[model samples]
Target: MKKPKLELDEPQPRKIIRADKAPTEGYSLVVDGHFKSHHDTVEAAEEAGMALKNRYQMLQIQVYDAVTKTRSMIEWPAPV
Candidate 1:
């Protein structure tokens, strides 16, 4: 028996917004998805982080900025 092949297509647009700082660079908000990367730029990374949080209610997320060579894990629901 031969294994079946799987095909992947471009992601559908759930929600897209023009980044204030990076106007030309837009962000896509996906549903029931997880994203992982080690790219630079905290702001950009955080934008994605917050998006995931807002959409999926993720309590925490990890971020790594190659440019600054920094890594940190951000958590939500901080003590008042």
Candidate 2:
């Protein structure tokens, strides 16, 4: 007899302007200065971040490159 799991083991919390770099080997999805998760490629990281960005639209999300120690901000274009 064991209790059923209600949620999967996934990082959902995201947000600011974190300047620190990730220590992991792959690209990291940083939300509001926090490392949410890591991806094998930049495309995957951006895609994941975009999902969150599209939902909230205000959270500051970025993809941190562990090798380059650089981060790129992701955003949606303003409505014309």
Error of 2 at 73 (Å): 0.3
The reply for model 2, stretches above 4 Å from the true place, is: 1-21, 78-80
Ten residues in sequence with the least summed lDDT for candidate 1: 21-30
Give the per-residue lDDT of model 1 (tens digit) for 1-80: 99998878967977443233222222322223233432245677666766656666645565544344344555454224
Candidate 2 Cα RMSD after full superposition onto the native fold (Å): 8.6
Please report how far candidate 1 places residue 9 from its true position, in Å.
23
| lDDT for 70 (candidate 2) | 93
* Candidate 2: count of backbone clashes, pairs at least 3 residues apart or interchain: 3
TM-score list, all predictions:
0.37, 0.67
The pairs that clash in candidate 2 are 15-31, 15-32, 16-32
**The CA-based lDDT of model 1 is what?**
0.47
Q: In model 2, which range of ten residues has the least summed lDDT?
A: 15-24
Model 2 over residues 1-80: C-alpha lDDT tens digits?
99998996888678433446455477998899988887889999988988889998889998989889999998875234
What is the TM-score of candidate 1? Answer: 0.37
Q: Would you list the C-alpha lDDT of every candidate in the order shown?
A: 0.47, 0.82
